[model samples]
Target: MKKTTFAFYRKTMLTMISLGLLLNCSALTFAEENSNTDENQQVQEEILVEQTEVLTEEVAVELQKEETVEQSNKSIQTPKVHFSIYFVAEANGEVTGQTKFDSLVSSDLFSNIVTAIPTPVANEGYEFSGWYWGNSYIGSTSSEVYSYFKRGAALSDLTITAKFKQVETPKVHFSIYFVAETNGELTGQTKFDSLVSSDLFSNIVTAIPTPVANEGYEFSGWYWGNSYIGSTSSEVYSYFKRGAALSDLTITAKFKQATPKFNVTVKFVTEGKGSLTGNVTFDSTTSDLFKDVVATMPTPVAEEGNTFDGWYLNGSLIGTTSQEVYTTLENTKLLESTEIVAKFVENTQAQDPITPPTDTPTTPPTAENPQPEQPVINEPVEPVVNNPGQAQQITPVAPEVQDETILDDATPEVINANNLDTIEEEVTPLALGHDSWSLINLVLTLGIAALAIMMVIGKKTTNDETRKVNKNAKVIGCITAVISIIIFILTQDMSNPMALVDKWTIVMLILGLVQVVTSFINYKVKENNEVESVNC
Candidate 1:
């Protein structure tokens, strides 16, 4: 029983195995068919896409052809323009002829355009002036005219012409004259004749000829027909007008005789110091002209222990002043010559340099033979010794009388006239009333006062320079004032106090003038400074 059952089970197992193999084969075949169908759809889609691309390319080519046709239609609508330049020829107020060749210019051409300028043809007795465009002138030659035309732009057609005219010139001539004289007499004459052109002018002579003068004569003035022209300087015609000078003219020169002069000699005879006279000039009596000549007089300088003496001319005292002297050329006295001498001597009023004698006489003076009182001489004196017996025997001597009156208290002292004359040799004469020392003292005082006043004025003003000047003025004024006061005291007695100011009147006047001038200058400067500041 067991063997039969096992056989049936085996048969069932085989049948199940066969069914499984069939199911697997069917599934694989269905999968293969689906893949082939997907491949066929993909090939159809690729073919449709290629056809759509070809149709778009054809549409673009047709649009390009239409655009090309529209461009060709616009190109035929516009046209280019061209222009030509012309030139003509003309004569004086007439149409002469035409030129063989003319300028050919075009508006189409740029800066590269070049046109030929027509050359002027030959004409009888006619000069070619220049080319002309209406009222505008070009040049005389074709080359010069073409240069002007080339520099311009060609806007339109135009024409130009060449002008001609005749030429002429003029001739001219001139002449000049000169004259000279010596000592109011004619000496010589000069004539200049020359040719000139309307356009040309020249100097007649480079210089004037010098005139000859006779002995004791001099050239005076130049004259033209009795009218004074000028000096003997050269005249010129560097600037001359055509046909202006045609006829010859005469000029005259004048002269005069030289003047006479005199010699003035100076001599210093005194101990002081002095200047007398020197070289001087005077005009001649022959000439009407007067020359102002200043002759310098000697400066009187005082020596130690001495004073200045007045000047003497021909042994006679003339004056004591040492100022500048003036004389005319016609003075006959000066022609004979002049000589002046200055004298100086010791000052007796000054303190004595030597000691005096102290002894007194024992005998009383009688009225008939009065003796001079013993003098207190400053100079050295010899001593006398009286022997008792010799004094009784000696004879009485008479006293000498002096020209001047004796003082009431002292007995009159007698001196020789000749000796007194020697002492008075240097004394100043009061002929002029003013004493030199007194005058000088008074002047100095006045000057000092005036200077001080000026200083004050300057100080009151504005400006640094003015102030400095004022300081100097003040110092000088003070010094002068002190000196003047000392001089005034020494010159006069104390009894005449008012005389000090009165004597210095001239000096004061001069000083006042100086102060006024200085003040004026200071005021002007201050005003100028203020004006400058305002301008700034």
Candidate 2:
């Protein structure tokens, strides 16, 4: 039983091992197939990705080409236009030829031409052919055209008939350039247009007309108001009339007037076109001719006293009672008037005194000589004077005289005169008053008061220490007191106030007051210091 069990176990083990190998092989094959399939799938996916990348690259290149084509189309679409026109004489008429123009179609020629063409009319048996030869089409849209036609035999003269149609009142500006040919023929060629001449037009037109004007019209001259017109063969004519009537012309009169007490001469000259007429009237109130003469003429005055008393005209002295006659040249009847005044000076000396005449005896003494011998009997006899004393006693007797005659003749009179000595003594005191004394007193009083106040205020402050206070106070007090004494001496009037007694009295009083105040303060401070020491 044991051996049989062993064989079955071995077979079972071998069968199990064989089954494991088969399973391993089947898994290996399945894994290999799956890996190969995955590798193929990866390769296929890589190819699809590369194809997508190539397609994307092709799409980008196409987009770039499309942009290039669009840009090229834009470049070709808006081309710059450049053109020029030239006038050429054809067989029968003048035609404008297009020398060069930008790329344009045939239909664009009509609008690009500068000139207009008129429709032909059939007259008689002649027919009008429209256009001869020329390609005038221009622009990209081909909406413009230009045509040229030759004149037929029916037309005798070639006339350029141009009718301007202002579709929008187009401001047509043109510029002409003249090209001189070698044969001395001048031709106008268009160079540019829309030229602005406002900056230099006035200066240019002020001189001569441009050469582009008609050759027949002559530009003559220009003035303030109007321009002159002239022809090639006739004289120039002015626009201003020669003699024109002026209305409401105002004439202003100006003349020189004399100033106060002075004469003036005026000379007139006209500036405007006119003649002045009128007499110049002058009044004595407004004119200074007579006033100036009177101011210059000297008046007469008394020689003895300061008084003006008379006047003289031309060396003729006028009396005080004479009428007020003015000096004038009116009666002289001269062409130019002149006045000559003579100044009169009166003699003011006192008049001479009159003398009285004394009476004398008119009768002659010779006829009365006979009566002299017959002396009067009543005449007293001559006294005999041989024996002196005794003869005098025997003299003839004389008649008695009246006492009343002596009394009425004369009386005694007494006269007294004042002495000059007392008068001079009295006038001396009145000449000098008390003006000096009042002035001196006022000055001295004010000066003394100011000095005393300065001394009190200039004292040292109370807050200073003892040594510093004493030193400063002494120095300041001495200086102030010395200055005050000096001021007192300078301002005092020594002559009037009893000399030293009155002048020094106020100064001594001020010094005494200062000393008293200083001494009292020093004593009080000393007592306070002593008390503080005892209490400590």
Candidate 3:
């Protein structure tokens, strides 16, 4: 019997050990499953982050490419053109330094060309003398040469020379004429160059073209290159082909005797468009351009309330308005509009005063006069006579009374009563002040809670330890929430009823929300743990 019992005991011990081993294996399995799930989630998050980065890089590259294309397109369009004029002087049958042409043609020429011409003096020459009258024809002593050719005269070769003398005061006496044509026909008989006396004179005719009929042509101050040929001098010339429509013309004139003063004028005549005119002065030292020579509409006037808005030339604002008007001293061929706009400002009124109630004033009283006091009187009162006959033959006498005295003690009592009333009045307002203090306390409480949460999260030792750490963190969060509520209640003042109620209501609501969230999270964590245990 003893042997049998020993064997049964040993078998039971083995069964117990096996059950323990099975439970250990089950726990290990659950842990491995949780770790696998965590690793899979981390991989998914990394993939999402990488995709976002790649998309961002692609957008940046596309934007860079678009900018490069825009820059390339801007590099391909055409540039503006510029022109100049110079005058060559002849003294004693030889050419002196070149000078800028300064003679006034039509106001149109001055307005268009004179203003647009750059520096009148050439960098390589001495001071520039203006255009002289004597050099009106080829081979003349003093002549004006234009650097730019008219559209129709692109193939023409023109030569001009002028003569000057200092005898009996400075003068610009000279003569000018053009070689008739390629056929050797001279337009005017004038001995300009010594080479014209020989057979080479015919060569001059071949090199220059004769004036053709109906090809609009005009000479400066002369019918056909004819001018005052004596001692005094005039500068500049106007030459045009017959019937040729003049569009953009730049004329520079120079004088040999006197410096000329001139003004520019622009006139417009359109088939249906109304006429418009503008004028400005010319500076001998600068170049000018005539952009928008004619305006499509009449000049606008500034309204009563508005100042000059901007300037417009042809119907468009060329630039903003300033005290100084805009001027173009160079490149005068292009024409556009200058625009003007009117500026107006709005008016404003002053603020009104606010009045407070007389009974409960916000301002304190000044310390000038002392407050008035209530008065008290000391007097002896006679007994009532109505009951005098009740006592039989009672002697008529004043009731025995102590010396009448005005006691100052009652005055102190009355003052104390007033002081108590003032204290009661201040207490209510002070309570409202306490409500404000409660709000500050609430903020500090939230800060402490956030700090505690961070500390708990930081103390977690391992991935598996997060559950225990989170459980304790929830308790701590609850405590913090309760503390915040207590602080709000204690600091709340009912004297200003709305003050304490409004402030603490908001804080209580927030703390309640926190409590709800913590409770839900704790419940979820517990449920999740239970599910894992059951599955194992």
Scored against the true structure, residue 328 in model 2 reaches a CA lDDT of 40
TM-score of each: 0.20, 0.18, 0.21
Candidate 1 per-residue lDDT, tens place, 1-536, comes to 53355446545545544554455445445656667576655664565456546545654565566567667866895544444455666764233433323233234442243334555653666667777878899787757766776776657656677777764432325555666664554433365554453222234433445666678777776675776756646332322323355555565666787654433333334433533344423333333221222235446666677676776656766667643122222232433334455676667663332222234334544554353333533222343232333323222443223322233224333334334543333322321344434444455566666656655565253457755655565665665555555545554343333343445456545654655565555556666767766887
Put down candidate 3 lDDT per residue, 1-536, tens digits, no spaces.
64465457556655655665565556556657777677755665565556556655655565566567667866894432233334344553344344343323222232233333232322333333443434443221121223222222222122333443333432323222443322123233333332323323232223222222222222222123243322112211212322332222222111232222222343322221122233222222221234333223233343344343444445544444322223421234432222233222333333322222333222222232121122211111122123343222221221211111223546777888877844334343324445334444445566656654544454332236547846665676758665775655565553432432445556555665665566556555666666676787
- Candidate 3: count the clashes: 64
TM-score of 1: 0.20
Candidate 2 lDDT over residue span 329-429, tens digit each: 22322112233332333445543321112221122223222122223323343322222342223221211123333444433311122322443322223
Clashes of 2: 15
Question: Model 2 scores what on Cα lDDT?
Answer: 0.36
How far residue 275's Cα lies from its native spot in candidate 1, in Å, is 86
Q: After superposition, how far is residue 351 of candidate 3 from its true place, in Å?
A: 67
For each of the candidates, give the backbone clash count. 4, 15, 64
Please list the residue runs of candidate 1 whose C-alpha ends up more than 4 Å from where it truly belongs after superposition: 1-81, 92-111, 142-147, 150-152, 169-536
